[model samples]
Target chain A: MKTLWSGSREGSLLRYRAMAFTVGTGLLLLVFVGIPIQIWGHSKAVVAVVGPIHGYLYLIYLAAAFDLARRERFPISRLFVMISAGLVPFVAFIIEHRIVASLRAEERSDATAS
Target chain B: MNRESDRQVRWVAPRALVAHLLVLCFVPGCLIAGWWQATVAMSGNGLSYLYAFEWPVFAIFSVVLWWNFLHDDPDEVGGRRLRELRRDESISGERAELRSPDFRTEDEDDELRAYNDYLAQLAQRDRAKGWRSR
Candidate 1:
């Protein structure tokens, strides 16, 4: 099937990474810069704007993560962890790093076996 | 998808039990959270309206993910790749994974056995002719 990815493992991984960071940054801004300022500064402006943007970006993040998980065939438990990582702060960045490390390790093993 | 009864669907399996629990608890949790957001939206919080919609979508996503997980065989996905890279010299990941055998559907296992047998016959015939790919 035609997808955002070019049917290459590398392409999907790259896409997932890009989405993770984009979503991560969106969440960070919403939590730190947006919500805090809105609370103390008596402004609905930042939360009103950043809130929906982060919400929509999260949907994209879910799609990207699902695509990468399908390509990689990650264990269901691991996939659950990856999904949860998006809901919490700073977890997506850590999970993404771990996923990259594991993927590299798998590639190394595949190279040796082949 | 139209396979026979050879592949048993393991609904009560340990992993499936966990998945069932997750679906039961998570779906309601999301709907309730959505309800709370709806109330907040009614109170004039515009952003809460978007959140109210998003929560139900999250619930739907969880159900889909749970179904896929229920039907999944942990390592039988050929490493979960959507497609094999078809290069002349490439060895499929399944063949390369000698560590542990994945439990595939009976139909697929039989097909794989037949294919391997065909390859073996070709190799034997090639050796008998005293030349390879000539």
Candidate 2:
């Protein structure tokens, strides 16, 4: 029952969540559908569309990850991992899941404390 | 400060100067490549058409990043202010003139301090949990 805005005191977390979802979906389509079609069917059409879309989404994902990292004061290595998550298939989903859970747990504890 | 002196000292600090020099070198290259792609696209190369527009966009983004870096204040850059604010978070500005107040009320300050402490404890716990899971 946690909201996007609930625990994100710095306001970057929600934006990161949205970007993660988009990057995750884009990568999934490109990897699962587009690459398969390009390899087996001898057609470049699916890759032609999904590849550029994923690239653009990945750019936005990088920006979002940078924003979140700055707000969280994350180390550069952690930020690099977050930014790279969008490029690999299904990694964004896992990272996003961890991020959301931690944020929610922090928020729940803060609510009880206050 | 005189305009030329200001430019030398601040606008083109050694780091910014290097960055600006790089930008100057690359923007024209990108534009030239974009132009070549445009010509190729005009001659009916489909993939070159997409890149024809893309290279120019890259040049523009580089220019924007350079401009932001040139004007950015060292202390106030990015989220530093936000981090400071969180550290000294208060509900009211009643003690604004005091800069750093020695005696803080127990209510709002306590909440923030407790939250920070909680976060520290959680981080330690999480590190332990990560090790355990591995």
Candidate 3:
């Protein structure tokens, strides 16, 4: 199990994973922590602070994920799902894990065979 | 524009229809959302401004993607039927890259010699495989 933080390797997945985690945590904060406060508690502080940050992080996540997806030759449908993972809370994290595992499984024996 | 480019820009293909409908719904929807967010921001939820600005960008991005899908050629770069799946693609792609003539073959070092030998072996194996297939 390669923990996301344990390796600083510059593989294609690393940047996308980092962005996914960043955007995922930001979204979790915005939805679970921020929006609830805004709605029920009548406070905009958390949403104000976290929302823009999430917006920008989502942008970076989009670019990173798109680049990696093309490199890995993912189908268009998977690319759309990857794009949407940013907007849905916790989905980014789930998709990130899927991406990492998929890429590893792909390259495992194949990497050395070359 | 040429007739071929005209055919590509037509929006009747099933995938093209999907893209067309999405852009139809998405761009105006984003704008409306942006306007609504502007009202929310005006009412003092300062963070609503983020979405106010963001929605328009999303609308633009969708248009860009839609435009791309309209003109995409399945065999061309960025035009490969992106969602089309084929097993062994990863293996075949990597193999092609390894055999592509980017590496120096004639350097005097032992590694280069070995690489040249490896390339020769790959070529021989490929020729054999081609013969076998035929």
By lDDT: ranked, best first: 1, 3, 2
Q: How close is candidate 2 to the true structure, as a TM-score?
A: 0.50
Of 2 and 3, which scores higher on lDDT? 3
lDDT of 2 at A92: 87
TM-score of each: 0.70, 0.50, 0.64
**Which candidate leads in TM-score?**
1
Q: What is the lDDT of residue A84 in candidate 2?
A: 70
TM of chain B vs. native, candidate 1? 0.53
Model-by-model DockQ, in order: 0.20, 0.08, 0.10
| Candidate 1 segments exceeding 4 Å error | A1-4, B2-6, B74-134
Q: Could you tell me which 10 consecutive residues in candidate 2 chain B have the lowest summed lDDT? A: B86-95
> Which one wins on lDDT?
1
Task: Give the Cα error of residue B75 in candidate 2, in Å.
Answer: 12
Q: Residues B1-134, candidate 1, lDDT per residue (tens digit)? A: 34423567789988789889989999999999999999999999877999999999989989988877766664466434322223211333334354225332355667787876676565445433310112
- Model 3 over residues A1-114: C-alpha lDDT tens digits? 364334233455788888988998998999899989999999988987887888877877877776776566565677798899888888888877876765664456356555
Q: What is the lDDT of every predicted structure here?
A: 0.73, 0.66, 0.72
User: If the candidates were sorted by their TM-score against the true structure, best first, what order would they fall in?
Assistant: 1, 3, 2
Question: How far is B60's C-alpha from truth in model 2 (Å)?
Answer: 9.1
